[model samples]
Target: MSGTIAFGLFAVVFVTSALSGVFGMAGGLILLWFLLLALPATTAIVVHGVIQLCANGSRAWFSRHYIDWRIVAFIASGGALAALGLALIDYTPNTAVVSLLIGLMPVLVWIPKAWFRFDASRPHHALSCGVVAGGLTIAAGVSGPTIDLFFIRTQMDRRQVVATKAAVQVISHSIKIVFYLHAALVLSKGQWGMVLLAIPFAILGTRSGNAILRRLTDANFRYWTRWIVTAIGVFYFLQGLWMVT
Candidate 1:
């Protein structure tokens, strides 16, 4: 990769990591959007999984005390089931499909809490979230908005929500990496180097976003998260439409 391209990738990682650190999902959505512009569908999703694995792992570690292990275990099992099903079917989303799926993700966040009572704390609900969100993550390259629907309305405060979701995403991203490993191997050494170099920036960006996260109230966090994701979804949906045309 040229120095300019390398720098651009690093910058996107940092910025998106930071965004995730705060809202816990938008950054990955944005990062995947940027990646899809430069790489093949599966390749971009794998690269995105690698970067997000770092970001979510560090974010989970930073807030380890807040993680709910029971929820994690339940959701992971569901995610695994979804992965197995997808792998067996040998599914691979095209760029336009991925973009359209991602673009539609924001709508999950907009659903009124009264419309669908999804509590991530419950075993069945969490498991369902795992299957649905996990499948979406693999297909679309990001599932934050979908995952958020389960946690945001629960009694858990913002800290617990972020930490637990980060932990969930860490596992989810790992599954994505494995699912798309073959596609990722097609990358050249130089491209892989760019991805490796971008890791530190991802971690750093998470740290920076965490710092800002402390200041936001629960209400503000939810408010901004909804609008920001909705705006991004609109743009992505349009892009997907254009691609299809």
Candidate 2:
């Protein structure tokens, strides 16, 4: 990649990772956009997956006690199945289709999660959510909104929601990365260097996000998640259109 592209990727990884800390899941999707522009789709998916694995793993561990493992299992199973299928297929999603889904996901889940007050008390149908999240994450580098909706419906406490989501993503992304590695997607030296450099910034962003997280109210976090997911969905929709055009 050119120096300009390298710088762009670094900037994206750093900024988005920080955003995820504050917003719960948008950071990965934001990074996905930059990567799509900066690298090949397959390369972008794996590289972003690896970076997110590190960033979210740390977040999961930092708030280890707060995780809801049941949800993690559901999401992971779906993710694993999806990743396996992705490795075998070669279909590109219709950008317009994805864009519409992205726009609707927030409207469908966020409004309910935020306004209706769905907490952790509801039964967690982990396998169902996991399968959906896993498949989507494999097809799209960031599918946090899909999984976030599942959690939102449950309305767990802020910490539980954030920490559990991180844990779930870690498992989901880890599976995707493993599939990519086994498939032998090529990475240039420049690409590797840029990805490595971005790791530290991603870390810094997560730390800053965690600190900022302490000051947020439950309502604020919900709103932030809603806004970020909606924004990312719109972005993907537009990106798909650009690709087809």
Candidate 3:
């Protein structure tokens, strides 16, 4: 990448990581879109996985006290199993199809709550959500919206939601990296350096977002998160449509 493109990647990682640290979602999807603009689809997916691993890992660590370990354990277990299965199959979807699914994901929130009455507090529900989200993550490069469904009915507060979800994503992203190891191997030294360069910015962004997250009321946080995610969804939807056309 040129200096200009590298700088742009760093800026997007910083801003989106901060957004994720505050909202518990949306940032990864936006980051993926920016990365796809700069890299091949497979390379973008692998790079996005690493950047998010750092971003969410930092967020989970910083908010360690609030993380729901039980939920994380259940989700991680299911996600890991699902991911392992996916890796064995070694299936890769068409980039346009993946983009379209990701574009449509956020709109799932609009579905009536009554249609899916399962409580996220149940261990089985968490595991099931993990399986589905994990599979989708491998295929689509971002499954934050699917994961959000598992938590929507839970009694967690804003901080708990962010912390727990970040922890769960840590597992998902790690699995993605494993599945994408071939792509990682093909990266040039400078590209590897670029990955390293993005980590600190991700950490900084997470910390900054966490600081802001502390000041928001739960209602306001949810309100803002919904709109931001919806806006991102629309952007991805258009991009995907244009690509297919």
Candidate 4:
């Protein structure tokens, strides 16, 4: 990677981490898009997983008090199973397909409660969330939107939702890195260094966003999350369509 692009990536890591810290969504979607610009589809997905692992790891720790262990365990079990199945297939990501999947994912949050309900607190629902979200994470490089659908309507407050999602992503991202580790071997040592250098920024940004999260009312938090993700999804969907044409 060029020094200029490397520097830009670090900046993105910080900014998007901060964004995710606040809403616990959208940031990964944006970060994956940026990575895809500079790397191949599989390589970009691997890099994104590594970076997001850091971001979500710290976020989960920051909100550890609110994490629902039962929910995490259930979802993680499903996610692991899903990852194993995908790994056996030797899945390869396609950029346009990733964009389209991510773009369509935001629609989940808009579904009416009467039409379909998802609550992570329910064991069955949580397991289903894990399978769908884990598969999406590997196939599309980001599953924040699909994950949100399970948590958003739950009785859990914003902090609970953010913390639990972070923990889930941390686990899911680990599987993603291992699944695509070979593709990531193409990066030069210097490029890997650049990727690692983004970590501190990711941590700092997470801290900054957490500070803001403390101030948001549950109502405001959900309201903003929905709109931000929808806006991003529209952009990604358009980008995907353009790529196809």
RMSD of each: 0.8, 3.1, 1.3, 0.8
TM-scores of the models, in the order given: 0.98, 0.85, 0.96, 0.98
Q: Per-prediction count of colliding residue pairs?
A: 0, 11, 0, 0
Write model 4 residue lDDT over 134-192, tens digit each, in one string.
Answer: 99999998899889889988999999999999999999999889888898889999999
Kindly report which residue stretches of model 3 are placed more than 4 angstroms away from their true locations once superposed. Answer: none
lDDT value, residue 237 of candidate 2: 69
Q: Model 1 lDDT vs. the true structure? A: 0.93
lDDT of 1 by residue, 1-245 (tens): 67987888999999999999999889998899888878989999999999999999999999899999999998888999999999999998898998899889889988987899999999999999999999999988889989999998799988899999999999999999999999988999989999999999999999999999999999999999999999999998999999999
| Pairs clashing within candidate 4 | none
**Candidate 2, poorest ten consecutive residues by summed lDDT:** 113-122
Task: Measure candidate 3: CA RMSD.
Answer: 1.3
- Candidate 1 TM-score, true structure as reference: 0.98
lDDT agreement with native, every candidate: 0.93, 0.72, 0.86, 0.93
After superposing candidate 1 on the true structure, give the runs of residues whose Cα lies further than 4 Å from its correct spot.
Answer: none
- The count of backbone overlaps in candidate 2 is 11
Question: Candidate 3, overall lDDT?
Answer: 0.86
Q: How close is candidate 2 to the true structure, as a TM-score?
A: 0.85
